[model samples]
Target: MNLYSAVSKSPHRSGTCGPNYLQRLLRLDSPGTQTILSGPESKAMTHYLRSQHDVIIVGVGTAVADNPALNCRIEGVGLKGQPRPLIIDPSGRWEVESEKGLAECVRLAEEGVGKGPWVFTSLAAPKRNQKWSQALDKVGGAYISIPSSDIDGKKDLDWSKILEKLAQLGMSSVMIEGGGSVINTLLQEKYLHLIDSVMITIAPVWLGQGGVVISPPRRADASGQAIPAARLHQTKWQQFGDDVVMCGRIKQ
Candidate 1:
């Protein structure tokens, strides 16, 4: 699968990697819409990609909003060996006791063959959250401190930095399932070059709400207005259940 191929090339020069491939998948409504979007096909594709990738990443926003297990589940098929759940928790708010926190989720999934989640946070995390760290350890989940783009309380991160860290930790690839802003940064023109492939599952319905939008590639026109450039050049599309799956590669 190209999804696997893209991430397989995600390691570093100091380590082993087949090729440098960074891929992303998101579900969207129509085109240029920001809202909740997903269907049966998208669900199936999401599970498959999460299971296939070496690591699954969701920014803290998604972690808080969705509380996803990050495990592959397909009705009767069940989850195979699930990939590691990587949380971009710049604020250190994904505590074990935080209702839908990954720590608690892992504990609930402990009955199955699920592995603990891996939380990555900024160095500026509040010292008071030591108890949160303890809770993570209690559930087999671990928190790792990484570089941050911290400005006051507006903590952010460069995905490239985390990708480098993952490479060192023996993770050759990663799939980012997100909550908008994070994916927007990665897919922006400057960082877009880093991504190897793009896959999106589009549902037939529309949610006009400004929840979170999975943006497509864009470029500035002669008038300096950003316009929607073509998506992937070589893309394949398929209809599954109530949604359609689209896959394509980022042009080098």
Candidate 2:
């Protein structure tokens, strides 16, 4: 199965600016402040991509910050037809009580429109406090245990193991929407080989360097020649409202 990591960024390459920062940038009454980077057409494209994949995955940071429904809302696709929602929470820090995203998934299931989410956590996470257990019980939501690695003092999920498990569950394709860390990690040397393609939506606004951004890794060849961390091949671009979506395969 192939993995697709999608991200939306400002023209300056910033991925996200917190609510307060974004609010400060635009007129308070502007309806698009929160979603300044993703317009209607871009959103529809995202939903279309979700409908085409077997599962939609996001990091725990995104799950908490956006509290996204993560379900496909495109035309003609019913609840059951939506891709499964998955979150990578290696330490099991997700709080179902506060976050509405998972709850939204369950509500859809109650209406017979969709199923709940599957949270991928580390085996070391506290077994008794599986907070996702109760809500997920109502809609066939599950918890998957996978390996984790330490990246600069932070514990992150092992993409290789996660992919292997997804394949075992019969998932043919997965789409990754994220917090900046997840997108950047997938493009780094360690996990770059696992990604099949990347789709980035670029907005016209510039967020400058203070906002979140993609940081490519720097490395060198055997003879000490500088080499790019990663590269894209056969790139394609299309406009979606005020945004431009660039799609391409990761050069292997």
lDDT of 1 by residue, 1-252 (tens): 222224333441111000111112223433322234455455555666656676766677656655556666645434345767678887678655665444535764465545567888777776536776676666566888888764335667765677777777778666765656666656566555566666666666654453345554567879999776434668788787766666777554
Model 1: lDDT of residue 208: 48
Q: What lDDT score is found at residue 50 in candidate 2? A: 73
lDDT of each: 0.57, 0.65
User: Model 1 scores what on Cα lDDT?
Assistant: 0.57
User: Candidate 1, which segments miss by more than 4 Å at Cα?
Assistant: 1-37, 74-80, 99-104, 150-155, 215-230
TM-score of each: 0.75, 0.81
* Model 2 C-alpha lDDT per residue in residues 158-225, reported as the tens digit of each score: 88777777777777777776655676777778877677677777767775544555566786889999
**What's model 1's lDDT at 9?**
37
Output the number of the lDDT-best candidate.
2
TM-score of predicted structure 2: 0.81
